[model samples]
Target: MLIVSTIGVFIAQGVQWRNHLQRIESRGKLIVAVRESEGIFWANGQEFIGFEKDLIAELERELDMPIQVFAVRDLDDLYGALAAGAVDMALSGTSFGTHDVIASRPYAMTRIGLVHPKTRNIADNPDLESVRTGLLDPLGHQDATKLIDNPPQASAVYDAGRISAELFTLVEMQDLDQVLVDERDFQLQQSVFPDLQFSALDLPARPISVLFNPREDGTLLTQIDEALELFDGSGLLGQMTDRYFGDALEFDYVDNLTFEKHLTARLPTYLSKFKFYADLQGLDWRLLAAQAYQESHLRANARSPTGVRGLMMITLDTAKEMGITDRLDPDQSIKAGARYITTLKNRVPADIPEPDRTWFALASYNVGAGHVEDARKITEKLGDDPDRWIDVRKHLPKLALKDYYPWTRYGYARGAEPVVYVANIRRFYNRIKKEYPQLDEAAEPERLEQLPDIDVPVFPGL
Candidate 1:
């Protein structure tokens, strides 16, 4: 009996020793499982990006440790990896489905809604009611031949096969009616293809957060929690949240009132110049104006403390590269800015979609194209969607860190600035779009005229 008791004590001591070692090792590094999507968190190649990026960074700082993010195919894959000890935890803001994974306190929330092609003429839910009644055919399987011919007038269709890539092709080809898709996807689509339009309906928000193994308890989990709380306290979490989801981030109009007043006065000066440049580039003048407003508040004299100068805030290096002698000259600045942006857009991989392409270009514009390229390669490595602005933007700042950038082809960069720049641009774009509803209509003719004329220069090859 004494021998058996001695053996039991030995087993207990071994377990205690293992636990102590785990706590010690946990202090040095934290492994977080993420996904391969764009917005919530995903791998872009070798880089992990999205809101989770900022979260992880903040957590690392809080715990005084390094974070190693692992990319999975999707949220399900992440959960499985966590269960199997393939990953320490997941930071994908994964939604709580009926599946039983251990989830921490809810970190963020967003309503999920349907998205569709902009050309679909879906102005609102009421428009959908008419389509349901029969203004258009309810799209269905191609082999099923029998579409709802003259069926109830409806605004949209919900069939699975009808709303995927095939449906988008059909819309491009003018084949079927509108497709019902996720609203976030719609926003992403609209950003990439500014020509696409969509509306939203109130739906239950999918509250999301990090998930962990139920049975696992180690130093890493506690450190992550501490980081989360620290970020939340410092307002960085809120900042990151707003950086991704406009609604999630809070802003004060009072602080913006003076800037708005100044913008109201300064915006008009760029209208004609914006139109001229937009026409030249085959872009919407309003979008250009929106971009300008976002960049420099339409101020010709605007300058960032970072040595970015002039009305359009063109960097001296960028100005010199573009062969502009006058950085403050509005016409030259606007022209050079437009050309540079257009060039950046053309440089992005063709497969990367809108908003993301545009966002990447904008990020490259803020940082350098090379840095943006590095971030993209990292994104691909991390398993996040490199083609997504929502995903890539999160990874952009990681370029600033040597450990992360060493793995990329483009080397290192100052990444955090792009995140702020892109988010600020998005907010200004949304604000301008809301204020000037007719701007989109006015900008259409200019975009259409320039489309065929614009020569998008290919990267590496060009």
Candidate 2:
């Protein structure tokens, strides 16, 4: 009788799981709970984006349904919702629970470490209480007691609502001394604070995965695992990783030092000019400044052998088109360059989405818009999506090859330069945005020639 009762219990649990999954399918939306942070989830214009957000989209596609994101304030809130089935799953930082409750596959990882301002030098494996210490989380994870000197006291942690990057800012301002950090969080923060130092603690990397309720049934879990397997194998995971964390992975001391020197010594002189012209064109001034730095190392007197001149390195013909009588005058040069980028962006198809759309425009700014269109033709011929930057960029380099360019209208261009040019500008722009958080991008501006959204330009000399 006892054995029969246990079997009946198993049947009841299976029925409950079926009902849960059916309700989700009938509703037509899978609700996901997330803790919104820099790399996890955040807003991009009116639409939202991040690694988790992208994964949710992938999951939506895999399951053939829509996914809704419900943001919880902190881990405790996140866990409570998951336990009560208020959310179908969670996509956030590492979640610790009993084996049956956790998803089997890890989608991401984060290393635990100690981070502090450069002003303080910490020795290896030093005691936590010895310094002005804080934590990434207020309510500690499951293994907190085993990982550190003393478990994180709720009072010792920073405000739970503030994201890790914001705490890093407090560290930079000398208001906070030390904090426990997740390397993934600091990887994004490093763009903003090149001077902060990091030392990894002797702890295993935490694997981030979606958490579901503990149950006898594995139907939902099985679907999640299958979707993750396909996403991982298809290389979409790597592409998403690159989009979020690639820029910061390759660290160069000299490049950072040069950026630091110019940011402090030269940027103040031309900051207002960059902002003014950028506002008039509805572009980010930090992005424009990054372009100028790329062109001429922030020198007003900068000139190239190709006869491009001034801060933006505007070509004579291009300068003339924008009414720039003096390319050497920094203000005139910035305005003219801003106008040209908008012009190139206007040539891009309106159906494409930004970041990709802006990247396409920057590519045009490097090589002419005609050559980019030629590359798009090549992309289409190769059975790839022409609208995507990833697909178009791969084909763009083909234009330089003798075999490929002969078939194209704008034959034989340095297709490789635009790829490198756009990458450098993005790196510089990320750093500059973090370095100067005080600079707010201006609101909607008067469009140029009724052109739509655009990016900052790149000089043709690239």
Candidate 3:
């Protein structure tokens, strides 16, 4: 009798689990956990570029369910939210060994190390002592480095915030002798702070894999694992990693000097045109120049093979749609471009955040608004963040897929082009914002530029 009851209980539990999953599927949306931070893999931003984004997008395509990203304060908070069932699953550059959440196969190998300011060094071998280190919070003491006590120095261990930021801050402020960090974080910091110095002293052990909550149905874990397999095998992950870290863009000192010299000379003359549009749009003129530079290096006669023409590469179709008949006129073109960009913000779903909204608009400008909308529809269907550029941008490429397009409200688009186009624009935007402080105008063009003549471009291509 006892054995029979136990078996009966198992059968009932299976039914309940199956029903729960079916209900979730019927709902057609999945809730996922993510961490909000800078250096990539962040949800809210102008540029959402990273390897993690690639994996999540693939999962959405596979499941054909929309994925919603929910962010918690930090790793500890994320796991706590997971345990509380506040999130269906979580993905970040997080490590395992936290709460015994079921884990998928390791996606990538991340090196853990102690990072310090370039100006400072281990005073002696003993200085390595008293240095506190950690991967994430709970892994806090696991592979942490401590003072040998031979020199007996005091150091405070903090598992606070993203390890990357903490490490960056530590080096930036020369706060600690060293802060534990991953090689990726160190490299990222190095790119931003060339003068700063830091070293990567390896942890005592191997890095751990990311984890998810174990479920009896195993479906969630299975989906995640399969997605990881696909990403790893497809080489997309490797490309993203390489794009961010492998061979970062190198500025040519000589060429840059020449360009700067030219910009200094010509910019003053052209500055009036930019200022004209900036004032009209109530934006900083520098931002208008930045946009022009990104679109065509401020070249008024720039033309692309695709038939995109004019200073801003405004297609003839766009000019007509924007009610501008003159394509070559700089002032009219710039104003039309600004208005068109503004229109994109209004067109994008209200839920999407700023910068990302801008990114989607730019993608639409390069591609078409219909394609962007189609990507968003697909994003909604696939259980991803439709409002998030990181999530929706991934779907942009799929519009070209015949099978994928039929299901979308807007059909058949060359999705891959937008990703590259937006990425390039993002790089250009980031460079200007970083290198030129005076030009920054809340990172918004409308608020910063002053408009004079509204020159709209006429492209031969649709």
TM-scores for candidates 1 onward, in order: 0.44, 0.73, 0.52
* Candidate 2, residue 245: how far the Cα is off, in Å: 2.0
RMSD of each: 18.4, 10.7, 14.7
lDDT tens digits by residue: candidate 3, 1-462: 999999898898884434324544755676666554444464322334445555667678888888765544356766665554555666656434334576678776665555655556554455353554334444422333343122556454555465465556655665555565555555554544444444545443333344555442466667677877786676555545644544234333343444455455655656777767667766545555656766777777888898777677788878988888776788767877877777776787787665567777778877778888888888888887676676776678888998798877767778998787666555444444444445223232111012112211111110
Whole-model Cα lDDT per candidate?
A: 0.58, 0.73, 0.59
Better of 2 and 3 by lDDT: 2
In the range 14-122, model 1's lDDT, one tens digit per residue, is 8444442164354455556654344545333344446766676766666566666655433345555556655556754433434445666667664443334554554
Give the winner by TM-score: 1 or 2: 2
lDDT of 2 by residue, 31-92 (tens): 77777776677654445567887888889989998876776546666665566565667765
Residue 6 lDDT in model 2? 95
Please give the lDDT score at residue 120 for candidate 3.
60
Residue-pair clashes per candidate: 41, 0, 40
